[model samples]
Target: MQSAQQASVPQSDADRLRARAVWLYYAEGCTQSEIAGQLGINRVMVVRLLADARRRNEVRITIAAPLGDLAGMERALETRYGIGRVILAPFADPAGDPTKVIAAAAGNFISSGMKSGMTVGVGWGRTLYNALPFITGATLQDFRVVSLLGGIAAARRFNPAEFAWQFAELFQGEGFLIPAPAVVDSPETKHALLERCGLAAIFEMAGQLDMALVSCGGISQITTSYRTGHITESDRRSLVETGAVGDVLYNFIDAQGRPVEHEVNARAISVQLDQLRRTPERVLISGGREKHVALRAAILTLSPTVLISDEQSAKALLAEG
Candidate 1:
């Protein structure tokens, strides 16, 4: 008879390859690229093998190091920012993209703290969307998800409405999406939609959220907002000129975390910054050196009860103060 590990995996070459990949990832701490190089395969194949292993219940996440190892850094961030709590993911290399690790840490946080009968207001971004796969889903009664911002015409995977809907589906709960553009052509048009298009009800729901999960975006380049064609290059230049560092829920804000005086801010449709602050549990999940200024602004603006980020970003945040 075959061993338990062998029995779980098939006898095919592919299965054996996948098993090896799992060992490299979980046991040896080899990255996908390293595993691929060792196994004489492409990185994509290594990724697929690892993913398959995870699906086959062969992946067990054992915490080799405790989070307390970085307690000092975490505590310093919490004290300085006046955040209720701070969780940091280990990022050995400052040059590497820390989005995945930060998202994983945030996923663990949400999975552990989420309870039934809660209304959650959600913000959209690559980091937040990446957290979806890591969240532990359960069918809960009276659970609801509110998209804090309006949806875009483009059906991107990270669309605000898509994230809200998918998150709700995970819990088998109700999802409320604002059926309008995130940024309307004019403030008058924005008001008309909220008043006459029955979108006011969605914002009304957002007002009473038990928790708000949000992320910030920097104005350094063409990010999601610009990618969606809602913001032009001219707009970006103008925003930079106005001292805008980044945006929270599409609300362009300056370094001080105050909404910048811009036409974009006036026409954007989303929960007001002040109202978002009122949420009983406001969680901010974002990181990376590019967002250092924006993250600081978000903390100042939202006063988030919880902050999930990477080690390098946390250090930068502390050093800047």
Candidate 2:
């Protein structure tokens, strides 16, 4: 319910009546017939008022089911991470990989949560790529999608540009991408690409995104980051030795969520940490027992307002905390 104090001026009698009817119907569990009588309005008007409230995002309805069977853990993680919302997908095994389930959950959330006329930044991985089938595309207006990272060259499975382009296609929005390699030979080349070329402008656009969708990668296994051969096993070992837990947007970070000193981080072409944080609404998506530590670090580093994972991963996160 919106408080009268929240408004700059007093609400008109009609507006107040609408609020009262909404309160009676949704919050008070009153039937539309009952609400109509109390508000001295017809049942049809009450229905319209309730519809208006929901359309404005003022009244959200979430079934206490879904990953919600573990609602206690979801709430706890939200408090522990200072996150606004936590979403988890059910997994039969705590030790099993929860990528597909989590991806499906993330897909459902993205399909609904993303509204028209918003600029969104996207990060790519197997999880996000897998979410494609589950995601229901929509025709939207004034929507823009920005690829937060560079593309992997000759990558058969997942590439940043491919994901960004497909995601934009899903919403029929304009897509902005960094037309460069994900990792370069040297920091000097990275500087030249950002300054000399036009990629810096893309990063600048990303810095002020309305929302950012990202996921983390654990170092326990040679995942996509290593499988691509851009990040070698030796480099992974070196990163873990430097107290790195995992990477977000290829910015390898430690347990404290601080980027560790590494040549890989320096030469990687992607959105900067400062730019990522500048985005108000950030969503971090990843899950699995192996990623618990990395997920913890990602929560600290990204400070995402929303987190999506699996119940087992959620439990592991709470236990670790």
Task: Please report, in order, the local distance difference test score of every candidate based on alpha carbons.
Answer: 0.84, 0.81
- Residue 38 error, candidate 2, Å: 63
TM-score of 1: 0.80
Q: What does candidate 2's lDDT look like per residue over 1-321, in tens digits?
A: 333332433558657776787688667879768898887766656655654454445554443444447788889999988999998888878667788888888988997877788999999888888676456566678999999988877855478887787787767688999998888989999999999999989988897799999998888878564247588888889988999989898899999899999999999998877779879999999988778899899999989999999988887787873
Q: Candidate 1's residue-wise lDDT over 237-291, tens digit each? A: 9999999999998889999999999999998998989999999999999999889
lDDT of 1 at 261: 92
Per-candidate TM-score against the hidden true structure: 0.80, 0.78
Residue 179 CA displacement from its true place in model 1, Å:
0.9
* Backbone clash total, candidate 1: 0
Per-candidate clash tally: 0, 0
Model 1 CA deviation exceeding 4 Å by range: 1-68
For TM-score, the strongest prediction is 1
